[model samples]
Target: MTGVNIGILSIQGDVAENVSATRMAMDELGIEGVVSEVKNPEQISDLDGLVIPGGESTVIGTLSLVSGSLKKIKEKIASGMPVLGTCAGMILLSKKAKDRVVGEMEQPLLDHLDVKIERNAFGRQKDSFEADLSLEKIGISKFRGVFIRAPSVIDIGKDVEVLSRFNEKIVAIKQGNVIGTSFHPELTADLAVHKYFVTLVQKKN
Candidate 1:
């Protein structure tokens, strides 16, 4: 296959780790790809797939909007660009997000995924932890999921496919070309999720 260009939204979060993980994933899958950090809107045009890593949703959304990249990202996603959104990235991709104990949060979002997420559904930052996730569709039976101030999908649209659950809460889901996870896949050595995402990009190309 030709070299697939994968972009990681670098407005904030674990950008370098995602880049490394993605590159490793491509290599592990015997695929050709270049992983790059995307900080400008123009870069979205050359991307075969995008990853929004775990970070502060408000900060990521605000910076992307300020840099004029948010609109471009939405356009690309609308045009079938595959995206893997983790943690805060999942929040940014959701149609709605609210505080589990407080109420709704007024953060800027991509609003492409038709899921209602509960911000900090797992717990606060201090409560961050890792657990084994069973994502059968992606062919993983016990993938380690690292959650840090993660959010949970409280509601999902008809088109959404629930990939994994923890404590009966939706932790991972897929909607068309978009995949959202409440945990950070890059934080672990297993690259199953990243490999799956790279395959999505490969298929799209």
Candidate 2:
């Protein structure tokens, strides 16, 4: 509550949107915390939780590695720090990724979550769409999900828990301290996902 600090990887993507949604989620839950955009590796140390937003995975991964933040984030996640990764963020957190429309892609990934993801599995940027998800584990029956050039989990390891699915495809998953979603929860008015993530942070803190 009091000393909770959440960071959003700001290398690219919906950095501001995630921050705003996180702050709103904290407020709605009557929790106290600070949400900030994290750019440098040093910023990762003080964070109780982290959010990797939806954006270009290649660019975000390249920039994070170059800045040395990728290693730090990997270390933090391995150390049991709660993380919420959306869309491209989900790709980075995945153990492996392949481009469904384009073919195999060689990109940097944290590989924290034990799941195989298919990049652009939902379609291209123009194919971005919205759907309602039933994340019963997170206490939500119908949550609006925004899919923008999204990826879906094609394979999941035993440790991974499928949170939500679309058309029988895995769209959201959780494993220990890491949460990954192919859809962008920050793009919608619903704060359930963020709130669930905040609870993860709170439990960790």
- Give per-model TM-scores: 0.97, 0.97
- Tell me each candidate's RMSD, in Å, in order: 1.2, 1.1
Cα RMSD (Å) between model 2 and the true structure?
A: 1.1
Instruction: Give the best candidate by lDDT.
Output: 1
Lowest lDDT 10-mer window, candidate 1? Answer: 122-131
Model 1 regions lying over 4 Å from their true place: none
Residue 154 in model 1: lDDT = 97
lDDT, residue 113, model 1: 94
**TM-score of predicted structure 2:** 0.97
lDDT tens digits by residue: candidate 2, 1-205: 4668999999998899999999999999988879999999899988999999999999999999999999999999989999999999999998889999778778889988998899888788799898888999878899999998889999999999999999889999999989999998898888999999998899889
Model 1, span 87-190: residue lDDT tens: 99999999999997889888889989999999999778799888888999889888999999889999999999999999889999999999999999999999
Q: Assess candidate 1 and give its TM-score to the true structure.
A: 0.97
Q: Which stretches of candidate 2 lie over 4 Å from their true place?
A: none
* Residue 144, model 2: Cα distance from true site in angstroms: 0.6
| lDDT, candidate 1, at 29 | 92
